[model samples]
Target: MYVSARERKLLERLLADDRDITVGELAEELNVSARTVHRDLQGLESVFRRYGLKLAKRAGVGIRLVGEEENKQALAAELFRLSHHEYTPEERQLMILIALLEANEPVKLVTLAHDLNVTVATVSLDLDKLEQTVEAYGLSLIRKRGYGVELAGSESAKRRLMSDLLFRHVDEHEFLALMKETIQKRADAPLDTVAEKLLGLVDRKKLAIIEQQIEQVKEKLPFTMADSSYIAFVVHLALAMERIKRGEAIHFDPRDLQALQATKEYEIAHELAESLEKVFDVDIPNEEVGYMTMHLMGAKWRNRQGTMMEEPSLTVGMKAQQLIRSVSDKLGVDLSTDRTLYEDLVVHLKPALYRLEHGMGVANPLLDQIKQDYAELFAIVADGARQLFGDIPIPDEEIGYLVLHFAAALMREKKGWRVLVICSSGLGTAKILAMRLKKEIPDIVSLEQASAFEWKGKDVSAYDLVISTVPLPEEYGPHIVVSPMLTEEEARKIREHLERKTSAAKRMEKEPTARRNKPIIDTMKAVRRISETIVHILDGFSLEVVKRRSVHEILTDACRRLERSGVIVDADVVVEELRRRESLGGLGVPGTTLALYHARSFAVLRPSLTMYRLDSPQTVAGMDGEPMEINTVVLLLGPADADEEVLSVLSHVSTLLVKDEQSAATLAYGGEDEVYSLISGHLEQFFDDYWISMKE
Candidate 1:
């Protein structure tokens, strides 16, 4: 049975809340006026009656669903089953827009109305709403009494609109499943949802081929691409291929094309285009390659340490600094010294500005939730962006990404439990989830992020908890599914899950012999591994005065010291890697007179930490992308294939360096014994925690 989205919502609410709910409450919950609620409720009775239930309204008290529990459950089942295609007014309007955009010729309003299961008048009103939206993309909606309705615009604008719709409606998991053809369809499944219709814009067979081609060349790119970005790239190629086949051409400014050709992304794009020509047997244009290059540059996600500031643009860096200052002034927080925030903003805004100027847009599925969850922060960020980037018309999607960078910086913390955050985008939303968990819950020592595509075959046992934005298979173990924004209720659910795990662990402790499937030797080995790593680091740790005057010289001296101490097999190779890492970005910790030079290289034999005090201070770029004076150099190194425990311990030490002013002071000026004691104390506490986990 078919049901209006509103009626279905009202019915679901009534069914969920066994107690009577007033009309005012329902209206408020649904964000509608009481009159609208009454109108929606008018036909809900018939919908409920289909499953043998009744909607009873009292004279003065309120309204309630009166029926057998089984009947109510049956009605709920039906509602859930039909929810996919029961489009709301907004969804219906979106579908109509997609239909018009996808059409080659004018389509009859009756046909659209019939397809949407709405009246012709409703379709007309929807077109009215969509006119402004289309015009925003430099497109116009054409409607005539006899000629029917069609979208009139350049092929480029239409393609952009189509891409925007797909990104907004077809979620990441759904896009992957659709491309892989893994979306199982039931016999009664309806294939007319707004998302499904948007996906229809691309030919599935061609999409799969495009995906395969991208997979082959994706690793050749310099930086990692977020999963959502990967999906967008694939969709763009598929759409471009389809349009090229239809004899439509896309244009790129000749001057802009010249500038893009100098970029590495352009070269990669050109290579991919050549392969497409060979496979698809179509002539590809330089403009298409230029556009693809822009997509690659804009969608880049940094994968390695210190790479965020490579060949940084002075203009974008200053803009990032100014934006941070603006937000700091508005929020009354001193974020100007946050080096990580500054560098992240620089990296994000560099391409972000490009996308906006070129009329490229990305979809943020969590935009609404981000606005709802961080309303005040959103306004502040919006104000900051307006002041820093005047008249750029930055979309909320981009603003949402900015908010995540600031939010993660604000909520940054260090505690003692490991968590893995699996997300679809593996960029903005995932950062929000990780920071929110650290802020709301205690003892999350470290959090690792992976894309939904990367979750397969992961060592789940390494994490204290696995939380995913998308649902995982049952074989992956009990992971809590949550929204990217991580609503308060979802946070509460995660807290409960952790509490239950802790309780069970304690129970196991109480019964020593129960469930002894875990071998004693295995537990002892974990203990030994953690202990050995801690001891090795402490044994090699040293605080000495050095006469090196430059960053390169100081790093050389530090590497030689590590080499002599047998912590690294080769100092020269390690020095070169550290120097290369330094060139990418600043190693100096903000608000401290120390720089952390860290790397994971084959030259390092074990995890080690050492501090070198310079006789005279030297100027170097700070992590915040600003120059700062440093009198101390802190070196942290680990093997390329370090154990999880070893990595965690080294990460803990890194956090301790800038943990606070006192820790920084101690590290910079403290004597050798004092420094060793400080690090050992923290590591000892970490070991104690690790020991407990192993025992459990």
Candidate 2:
């Protein structure tokens, strides 16, 4: 049976992907029109029939290939064996890159064209496009009429490019399957797939040895290495050994080497190198060990026992705070108190900044999906990263990670559904995945985490849903599989699963004889609490024009007014409390002419937000620690033992201070009625959301 290039590509995607792929998606992926994909499907029907398979198409949903496993394997094997002269543009380009990277000497255009079964002109066009890609890796593609072509760059750049290609093109399942095969068995036969072509770079026996060594060393590391990172590290070491055998060398900066030598990773890398030298019979250079150390340092870590802040750098901590504050201001949400978000960012940014500074890159496999799903949040984080990093060019991968951190923070709440998360380590990526699930699915009331090994025989009956990072055996029963960085599609599937279960449960239940019989007393009480808080603040709310030149004088005068208005018992005590809060961190909202001086004090009589506009702007330290001019001081006060409803209302007021440019301007310069109108409108919306959620 003849399988065309695009057809073969489509079939591979169908078999590899565990989700239904729509015609639009396939069309976009193949760079063809939907009609073209339909036509291709028409031709593929006969091939599927031959393999005892059928194409299942659902309108508005997608297409899926349905068949027995044996039939599917048979078709895959046949396709692998058939060697017809056809290649997609991506395949052809990848072949050319691999050929160039492998070739010690320049390869003629005629040779490349002949191998790819394409015209020299076609190969030249591919090179024209490929040049830009190679350049991004700091490699130059040398082309001449008579001299042929070659890739020129540092050995480190070449290695990185090769690793990137492997990670990008090779399916994770295929890689895992290859790893499962015995070294001797794999070495006996040459695999013919494009993935195998990349895998051929590392010797099978050496790859096994590297994996074994890394497995042994895993326990010694302070933080748990993600499964993906573990695989990448193994590939990295195997490739390094193969390259060393081929007389290729990587150069490390002497200064960088000196710095790395001080690290624990350096000591571990040295030991690993020594062990490899005896087994491979190759002298591992100090430079090679230094590069290995760099990889160790750059690996994503999730500490088990304590927070990532053990011996933290104040600089990175301050940057994390600055980034959080910037994003909070732009997003109009107060996330300053989210300790988990703070820890996650600090942990993520430490290795991330290291990778950025060293010109090393880590692949965020879900970057495109992240950008698609959280476009606005991604933009906010990208902007925040720029403001924090300043001159540093933070890649979208890092920004995608930052978005996950903030996205999780935004989703922080518990309501109804119960979920159990099973992960390999049950600490790092698992925590991230759990947070993402809760963030994406707010119905998740409680989440329980367990390692893969620990969850083998555990009772999961209490959980409403079970989700895992890795695939489980049939005995584990039914569960959804998702990446740590949950994709939109995965979230949709999870929600669908939950909806189906809910529908079934509703069907099984007896019909209610009457509806609306019970009054919503709790919701009524909640509404009353929120309403009273809003009323108290608005009744005492006053926006005054003050002439105080100093912060102390301004605070004293503001507190005296509050005391006289019966909002507080003692003006002196309230001023002291406000000053104490100011000393903890700057009250000035960065990049604005406004300051939010808020405190929860026992001396407070009621929750209130009062605006004091200064006659002359005065400089004060910003929340980000930068000095800024403030022409307005917004004093927000609440009782120390205030209820959740009162605190929620006060928090909403804090958000209004920097909700947006117009809101900030209104708070800083708008007349009392205009500002009060803005606050009332936002508070009304907040109450509506609260009421709706309560009903649900």
Candidate 3:
């Protein structure tokens, strides 16, 4: 059986972890489909048997490699040796740049073409973009007829560019392993050799020593450096030896040298240089020590527990603010107020500007990858930097780092689904269901339990999904009806059902195609129908005027009051998660003071929603320092594990909160019996209007 490069990766992954891994987990890790994994496993079975291994799979339990460790290790080694021959256009360009930058002598275009397995014309065309990439690193691709091609620039700049190019793909561990293996045996017994080795044919012992020196310097530093900055140090330290052996020299402005020497990073660098001087039996330069200081200046602290920073100097903070403002205005996402994003940007930009001003081309080997991954984000950062710095072209590499700050702010770090379990056999059965669901599915954020009879009248809309032993016919989205001791096939069925429902909800607003007679497929009517099922949860709806106070206090008080009704279990957990959500970003609606405070918790028995009208306008912090004041708040609570139906209603309700806040509030606070009547009546009307608008 022949294996493809991708199949090899699959075998590697299965062999790497001894524990069983679900198809979904494998698909996610390898960035492929579950079906693809299943097919690959079939192809792999025959191949694995030759290695004295078997692909062990159990229903609902995932797959694992069952065999001796030695066989698995040998098989893994063979997988790594296979050449990844196929290359994207971007990959080809990066490969050309790597060969040129690392070449000790001027490498011919023909040689690069042969290495990449491409024609000379294609290789030449790749160099056009490659030149622009290298030019950013303060190096020029100088082609001399017959002599071939060489990178021409300052020796220091060449090393920076080389450092960036060397570790573009792999992390520190992989790079070091390759370095160690290639070094410890370069002159001894050899394996099959590729034309251009990734780790380079450098002195392994020297490379290892440099790596240790860098680790030492990094640990001793006051501030934590960015991953990119650390990579630069490794490459710089390793290449410094190479350049020095070739009798290369470095010089810096005397004043700049004095300034760098005064810093702790420079002092550390000075000691490293002294150690290298003794190891290599050669004098080290002061200019190289200055370069190391610059690397330390751009680092982030490893331990930033509440210690963000005592305010940076006015100019530095202002520069960062200027860039953030530009991004907000142009991109329309105001990240200017995220305390962490702001601080990170300020610290990074100051050192970056210092480097750029001194004509240091900070090589970003990941520039191409970053641009490819976050193209829109990179553009926004570039445009914003353009406005902030005027004509000082900030390298694409620098822009990539800036994008990371905003990217962190934009990242929604959610772990998994908050699940509610409903069982006909009561608490014992419910707990059993929770354990079964958790074992097969690792994505259960929190597992809460309730008897079907107990949960029927409680507010349960707060949970992401509900798992029940038996179906009791609730219109709250979709619920998984599973056996108390779930089977693997049944678990997969549940996952499939949930995925379809989640996909359908996402597609609802997108494909609003009028299927004239099929109102069941129509999202608007689906929402109305689902919303009506929870009407019982909002029974005896009456609005009491809330006095002005913290929204947390108001919500917590409501939870306690509902606890007397035997609707909630743990009020403390629900309230704390709500507060944590608020801290990440305010839930307060803009324009109207309607803050939608909804939480998912095991405490919630069933889906419940109600509105409270405050007597006076309560001011809450809104986005970008805008004071948000609202007289009405709609508090929605669902089962600790909310289902698709509840999620769909929450989606529609979120839309309603933004659009009809005042009207919804007035209708709610108007009359008690009339409130429920008015809401039920309005749903049909809202559905009709929304459907018509969607059609048009």
Model 2 clash pairs are: none
lDDT of 2 by residue, 253-294 (tens): 899798788777889889889888988899999999999998
Q: Backbone collision count in every prediction?
A: 3, 0, 23
lDDT of 3 at 10: 79
lDDT of 3 by residue, 1-696 (tens): 347656766786787566678999989877889999999888887888899999888899877888886898788767656556645466577667667656678999899888777898888788777888877767788886787888778777766666555555443445534334443665343322222344553444576677666665555665554434554566566677777777776667789788677566787888878877877787777887787677666443323221211112223455666677777777777775454455556566666776776665564444564576568988888887877787577877778767756654565232455567875432223444565566667665556565553455544455556777655555644577666656555688767765655745634532332233234456565555455634644462446667765667788888777777766777787778677656645555555556667666788876666677777777775532366776776676666555555544443333344324355454435665665665555555545544553343
Candidate 1, backbone clash total: 3
lDDT of 1 by residue, 390-507 (tens): 8688989899989989987787655456688998875787888887898889677667788877787576666667899887779778798886767565788778777777756744
After aligning candidate 1 to the native by TM-score, how far in Å is the CA of 96 from where it should be?
2.6
The residue ranges of model 3 lying beyond 4 angstroms of the native Cα positions read 1-79, 83-149, 171-173, 176-196, 214-220, 251-255, 299-314, 322-338, 358-383, 395-397, 410-696
User: TM-score for each prediction?
Assistant: 0.66, 0.66, 0.45
Pairs of colliding residues, candidate 1? 339-624, 415-445, 417-445
Tell me the TM-score of model 3: 0.45
Between candidates 2 and 3, the one scoring higher on TM-score is 2
